[model samples]
Target chain A: MICGRTPDELIRDIEGFHGFVAPGLVIGAFMVDLAREHIGQNTEADAVVETRHCLPDAVQILTPCTVGNGWLKIADLDKFALTLYDRHTFAGFRVWLDLNKAKAHPNVYNWFMGLVSKKDLPKEILIPAIFDAGRDILSVKPVTVRAEFAKREKKSKIAVCPACNEAYAAAQGTPCLACQGKDYYHTGS
Target chain B: MICGRTPDELIRDIEGFHGFVAPGLVIGAFMVDLAREHIGQNTEADAVVETRHCLPDAVQILTPCTVGNGWLKIADLDKFALTLYDRHTFAGFRVWLDLNKAKAHPNVYNWFMGLVSKKDLPKEILIPAIFDAGRDILSVKPVTVRAEFAKREKKSKIAVCPACNEAYAAAQGTPCLACQGKDYYHTGS
Candidate 1:
């Protein structure tokens, strides 16, 4: 149960951010709710989102994390999952959509099971069904993150390109490949 | 110059997909142009994009690669950069935004410089100026990718949850975590 927002209010907030509300948003909200329960009041946490999907939005909404802020890292595993790790303790929790529990909602279950292959089902039918399924269709488990990954990455050295006079990662080698020539293939050769 | 579409037309297409036009799209287009010039009809190539930003859109538009098709990999280095890798040969090229060259355009230069300073500028003035800076602010380099990254990742084994009858990655544990219980924290314990 989300503390302050009703399901309709949550959907509206998600829609405000994502331009539309869908099953992923509802599922993400539930996962974030679980994460919040475990990670109580530690706002300095970082999120490692395993997919480039709706879950990141939930993390951003529920936590003080953002890609621009470098607190959110997208792992792009394409699994509907995410991990919230405390930078100080390196303790974290991984949350995933529970395919088993998803079966209780026929629309979501069929989609996950590949029984219904349609990509563009009407939102009117899909959104409500997914929101109703809610917390029942998720798994949250505690995990520990490696210390190196939990810490913020150091900024790389920036250098000016002689030809273009633009800053680039000096570690990649300079004269800057793009400024040396337009032919991309010949640069490494 | 982009071959078929005029600059206005290209911007329109980018705007249609991205909802707004900005400098990142222009840089992405130029990168795609360089990548296309090298790869040349090898539709089997994969794109390894270094950022989760505008470059993916350009790759999706100009090439056969896409996240859904598993041909586009987001490296998430958070630099405005990308690499196009040939799946068959492991040949690739990298492109990055040239921050120094971006300075030739006063508006863009000041913005980039101020960006590091953390001054909040309004978007209306910022977006068009960055767009105007365009193709001049990029660096392209050819390189070879390691064989391992070029190869497609193996699909993980799937198992059905006994409680809900839906499939999940069995390696994480059985009965599936969500089916075991609702308490996310204690599930691991």
Candidate 2:
């Protein structure tokens, strides 16, 4: 109905060319599927379908990083493997193994996500959150402490050297003699 | 004028209390500096700040995805260093390195950014496109060969099946049909 070829025919073709004929590369299969489905037939929802071209291997794609074995290497698609992308789409058929075969890798617990800077330049993108599997369970955060912050008991008023202790309250515009000493250094800039 | 204390005084106090004084650990000195300027002072803006708290040659806060003195090790920051979360006071510091390190480590990347099929979840976050200084480069993408759509320049078609000698049609997938049958793969797929 969609492309003159019924879903059965399409499935047969896929079984023959993609499943039976094609080698292990997902890109080509995905491209063919995309060209047929989205670009050709336009049967599926636009947002869910993605057609990626000239994409690097997962390990290669994640360059400037230090992990390995990023690809979903397999002899066939039956390997309920590969996350983050559609199973049938070649564009989504990504592998994460290290092409280098040396060092190794995960995402959630280890990765740093999108960047939002003050020095603006380009358009912004919507990025989802990530979490790795089996290896790490803790979450990455800013500066959290292991202990809770409890109120400190108040102490009697004492003078702290402005030269060494930046915490002390100082007189307005008054220079302390501690700062005048040879090794004196200012604490509260 | 601005909170009465000079920036220099604060810097000294920070240095004195760092490591030698605090001992257990705090964020890196540079990260602390960033936090002070971006978090400690800008209280009117974002509400929170946290960090993985890893430093160099000292107490290592080995959490999930921590960032350390990468710029210092790679090269000095000459007014421009890649900072991933220097602006987001709530997200924490070391975003630049944490993100890059995620590229290097997917378990952590996944732990922090992986998305899985679920209900009522916050949604998945596949963090492949990280910051390149600022640009969103897919650090996880693999090595790709640039292809041309408009022109067919190079030795265009792949060689025919070596065993069968049949002019391989585009229909047969990668690693030529001849090879697959004979256990020899081609680039077709």
Candidate 3:
């Protein structure tokens, strides 16, 4: 079982939430479950998803952490890992699939290492293999969130951009992001 | 039509990728299409997604830019907007739903303003309203990406964290993120 449900059941839920059963979601379920086991159920927790892909969706489905709620932050460091910590204490567990250990599990390694393309992936075999290997292929490290990173930024003052006539964070100052040279389009001549 | 596909056709594709037809995706479809029309075809492009939600998926579906390719960057500034630019010139269009204009379309206004909860949303009505409103509720601005922001960060040197025995960007300096107190868990006593 993965995330307290059988792999089949979990896949259905993941499909409903993530559109398709991403291998990252399947693997992330194991990582999340392992971290939660270490943290226990009584404390308030927050998450730091280290990537922007399917792993963030896994955290959203398995934990209270979500992008909209500000409890989850996607750092996009390009690591297929995450940390779940006590909101009050800023103490948490970091979990990642250990590539070295995954070598023993060819299916997991193949997917993680990009040995097979998505269209050619054998999902039927991959799902069960992931469930069987479970957290055996993961690495966990205890960590404390940095003080500077833990503190939430206060709401900044708002200002209207002179160029676009739209409101923006006054802290960014002057014109607005579009006018400040971060625009994505040029006005047609 | 949204993104050169009929609403029904687009919805099916979106369902396969994003799980559901989010109103933001529907609105973002109009926003992305408008931006594309301004930029025209046959140009190398990159995108900066101002938020970390459905809009990025819309860009991924409609454009060649994607996070994996470093062509799309999700800034997560909490704005429901995006910028698509010429890769070489960094000149592009900024597109966002104008709240003031949205007031005329109740469904669009309700969703953007959070006047109704997701479970209670009327998808049958909302999808049509978005198509009818199209780019009418959107505001566009021509922008040039700031030189600093446009440049990609070079791959930094790698170092092993003394504390955690894990690899991290050497540029972050000493110990690594988990060792530097950016950790999410504390070691058990």
Residue-level lDDT tens digits of model 2 in A105-130? 22221221112331331211111121
**Regarding DockQ, does 2 or 3 come out ahead?**
3
Give per-residue lDDT, candidate 1, residue B53. 56
TM-score of chain A of 3: 0.91
Best candidate according to lDDT: 3
Identify the runs in model 2 with alpha carbons over 4 angstroms from their true place: A1-189, B1-121, B124-153, B157-165, B169-177, B180-189
Output the number of the TM-score-best candidate: 3
RMSD of each: 9.1, 24.7, 7.1
Q: lDDT tens string, model 1, A63-108?
A: 6565434577766344577787777776778877887677688887
> How well is each residue in B1-189 modelled by candidate 3, as lDDT tens digits?
666898788888666655577777888888888888888877677888776667777876677665434567777454678888887888888888786798899877777666686677688888888889988999987878775677766645555467655545667778677566555344551
Query: Per-candidate DockQ versus the true complex?
Result: 0.12, 0.02, 0.14
At residue A50, give the lDDT of candidate 3: 73
Candidate 2 chain A lDDT trough over 10 residues, lowest sum: A45-54
**Model 2 over residues B1-189: C-alpha lDDT tens digits?**
112324344334333323222211221223333433443444421111111112321111111111111111211111111122212222222212234443464432333332222242222222111111112211211111112211222312323345533323334565454356421111211
Residue B77 of model 1, lDDT score:
40
